[model samples]
Target: MAQSGGEKQGKLDFDESRIDSGIDSYKSISREQDASSDRSQEKEKACVTDERLDSAYVSSSLNVDSLGDIIEQCSISECESATDCEYTEEEVNFLTTVTEDGDTILHLAVIHEEECFARQLIDLFSPELMDIQNNLYQTPLHLATYLNLPSVVKGLVKKRVSLELQDQDGNTPLHVACEQGFWDCANEMIHNASPSKLSCVLEAQNWRGLTCLHVATLRKHHRLMRLLLKNGVDLNLQEGTSGKTALHVAVELHDAPAVNMLLNKGANVDAAMFNGCTALHLAVGRQDATIANLLCQAGADKMIRNMEDETALDLADGNDDILALFPFDDIQIMGRTVMSFS
Candidate 1:
């Protein structure tokens, strides 16, 4: 049946509108499919990257174990030379690669106490590799000293590994030895290092502002103290925090024997702190009669005034034992209360 022109025109317009709507829907679906494909590709790429990293990590770890096997098979005693031990390119590369924790092969070897392997690695590797620090900035020498492995220390020293490299706490290998009281390791480092290097190591203050001598005294390591003294450490070297010398530290700790040792070693009895308080001031302040007596006998100035302008006698105002050590005249004049030892 023929329809009227108006009806036909209306039908055509309706048909065109439906066609336009269909095209818009098709375009939306196409855009969605493209976005989905891009997301899938991205996921696949991420997976590939993760797999590579994992594989590399695993490979490097396996190489570390394999290196240990090589060391075992060709023991130091049997191996003609450290360089004679054959290594594959991969194995050699593993020496330079660090673990996630930033420990190189040499660090792991020392931590595991593979002493023989450590010595071999020390000999085989260059100074750069031998001295590579971990995340803690702890060199192999630092670990050897901390672990008290004197032989490993000797190996590192002979190879000229830097003795001055500090850990996270800014402690050099020598500082660690003195703090830990590892006599043999300390001795090895002290004697092997050149005179200039030894002096530098001794002078370096850690983050806590403590030198090797200060640490030894604070820790009450008498033998180590003696070793440091014998090595020519300044008897009156003051610590950074309060300018307290080893003598001041001893008296404050109530260490009679250490006080006597330092005095005999030529420690200045009048060496004052940043506060101008002598060891005697510390002794009297702490009410330590024994140390005060030791300092007095060692010729400590009883009248040395501190930054607070309080003499040892003033700090000892109420203590009769301490007051008795001072001359009657000085106590009467300077002390708040007069007490006569005679």
Candidate 2:
């Protein structure tokens, strides 16, 4: 208590330095604990985040795999049973190619006569694939007609498939049905087609300029020809290249029934080919006396010659009926008449 001024000042300075050092040490220890706690919290947070991410990834992957598996199972089961199975929108949309030639499932189902499968597929994905063309540029209806699947044709018609759709050869469904002798299919098409579409069906020609009637005649489908004629198919419509009528096709094929059908339908027997040879010429060349008589009765000109100046009599190949039927007076009259007309 009785120290000198200098001693007292030195003692006070020592106490202050000791207090400052203790304070610095306390702050350093607190700083170290805070750093350690922060590291632990960061690690815990990282662990939780990693666990959540892993769980989400697994859930997503499982969902995708499950969907894929369901689709594969459904397709396999349906195909094996040869029947259509009920499927949701998501199920039918599963990836499946049906055609061996890159046709869609709908196309294959329709063409192959898989009724159930076609129905199921149509109900699901028809809006998307109904209009899709195959590698041959054929629609589902085209394939259906080609395969002569009446049920499939009816189904497609029920779904309102475009009747005017054409294939690569510019053939409509009616063209195909008629060409393939699918009379019922042609009837279905005729019944469902609109008035404006009727002309297209009647007038649809193939690469050879053969209408539906020509096809029916070529196939000797008399009933189909009658149906087409009843629908107002032009009996005199000539082939574009050969200029041959339905009558000509019948005579060429020697199809007596078809020829009779055409003649009965008012087919012009006298309609000449490009070389001015009538159906009688063809019938006579084939030695078909019955057809020759039928054409003669139908007013076929016997004296008409081809580009080689050979008449049906000359081209008769020694058929006595032709030689006997063509009387000399009638021959002279026909020649004079044809010459006068020419």
Candidate 3:
């Protein structure tokens, strides 16, 4: 049966103007036209009538036998046509069916911020159904995390959905939370996770070879970093491309505070990249004296060489301040040690 032309509570119109409203709603608020203006009143009434007629036509033509038939025709119908339909056995079946885009009703519920409906769907759907990925390869939990929907995130987490499920970017739901700096969502997911499972997720690297900690550092989400660290995320986990640890990334970004935080968290001060260049090598290469000093204070080995056989001292040739961070006497000592070894 077609949903009525009159609006249902919390149901949004799916007209062209509002087709992408679920995502656009977060971007900005649309200005309302002055109601007292005669032209505005006439335009509003016309829009309402057009929408109702369009919805009625689509609903009349909607054939429910095939999976896409109902949704394809109804996509232009009122939002309630699909979401707030009568709870018949057929409607229940449609709720369970995966749409052509790979979305379940659960995914739509999260997208629309239909909290009460989403919670009811969560209870009705099994963990497996909740984990269904759409064409974008995002699960409802992934969408919830991305959209910063904490209550929905909590509901999904409580349902024990697979947090390890990675989206197209290889970002697990937790990775998405950290990437987007959604602290509440990350907190809910982590707190609800078992210790062993949490460990796996904390270490799960994305396609960029970045773990949740790496993502937090890249995004400059200090609070999220602390949260992951507190939950036992490895500070020294490296990215796949360059094998740069969070400290390496921080140093490269010249984020003194992040470097300091990672240091205090016991990140290996001299962790080297895949190229055999330590974080100190990066600091010296960039000639960042403050970071060089910080690394030296943290006991970064000065004599470490990269694949290019360039020591942090070798890279610090022209910058006196950075060179001074490694004492002249220390350079002589390092030189003699190399001489002796050679």
Candidate 4:
């Protein structure tokens, strides 16, 4: 393999041609252009880590009998003594290593939650290490967020890990934090991120048609919901293929806090789903009187009909208390009066 030495086999991975500054692509994976889809098979018998590269060197240049000397020096405890643990001149050439899945040591360390181990490696390595992608195309930040490891999340952020890398599902770590309701992790990202990164997180739609705000609301995570609102997410952004806003989701879940928060934030209560059922209709149909009353107080259109031309009152089965709250005669007059004023 040394006979075929070129950029990948014998050069620094971060040569001038490789590292594009201010960009957020994975691993600075300009390294990707060098590989075929079969790179995994190609890398199989090659020097995997510097550990293996040293072994290959010892076996080829000296003798296999000296292999134990290299192993004993590579230990964490042994590495504490600088003179005892220093790599040979050849070993330093392959210092950075990758797992079979294309994850750097940082990716593996964060995934396995080796806090002290990962921190030591991170402090020694460049922040660029955090940006490396695994076979799944998830950076350490994405993995850390998925695992809800806030310490790792903060450590990477402090190191200036690129916040923009997405997994195959188009989820940034901030998106994962919000979707998983990892509020502290999400908060760290929100407060610490660059304005552009924060905006990206705020507007990113996941595979499920949920932005971070929609996920927070759907999960009824009140603190996260308030945080998103304070940061100014579009309150009425319709979610999913069904065109349901966060308010619609809250109504169906009978989540009064989310419903009230959304209403107070000026979400359009009459915004209909694909079936033309307004928030009021959902609240009544689901028989959540507290949520229905909250919506009504927020000025939900009581007489707003579905595509079937059936009003929420009409959908109110046997629940006279719900029917009585509608004020059918009064809402008609009030609607007509509002239309006249318009």
Highest lDDT: which candidate? 1
lDDT of each residue in 164-225, candidate 2, tens digit only: 77777777888887777889888877776666777766876777677778878888777788
Q: Could you give candidate 1's per-residue lDDT for residues 164-252 as a string of tens digits?
A: 88888889999988888899999998898889888988888999889999999999999999999999899888888899999999987
**lDDT for each candidate structure:** 0.73, 0.63, 0.73, 0.65
The count of backbone overlaps in candidate 4 is 0
**Sorted by TM-score, highest first, which candidate order results?**
1, 3, 4, 2
What are the per-model numbers of colliding residue pairs? Answer: 0, 1, 0, 0
Cα-based RMSD of candidate 4: 12.9
Judged by TM-score relative to the true structure, which candidate is superior, 1 or 2? 1
> Which lDDT value does model 4 have at 224?
84
Tens digits of lDDT, candidate 4, 62-148:
111112122222333424422233443444433355545565656645544556556655555566766877666788888778877
Better of 3 and 4 by TM-score: 3
What would the TM-scores of all predictions be? Answer: 0.75, 0.63, 0.73, 0.66
Output the number of the TM-score-best candidate: 1
Q: Of the candidates numbered 1 and 3, which has the greater TM-score value?
A: 1
- Candidates arranged by lDDT, highest first: 1, 3, 4, 2
Model 2 CA deviation exceeding 4 Å by range: 1-102, 120-129, 168-170, 330-342
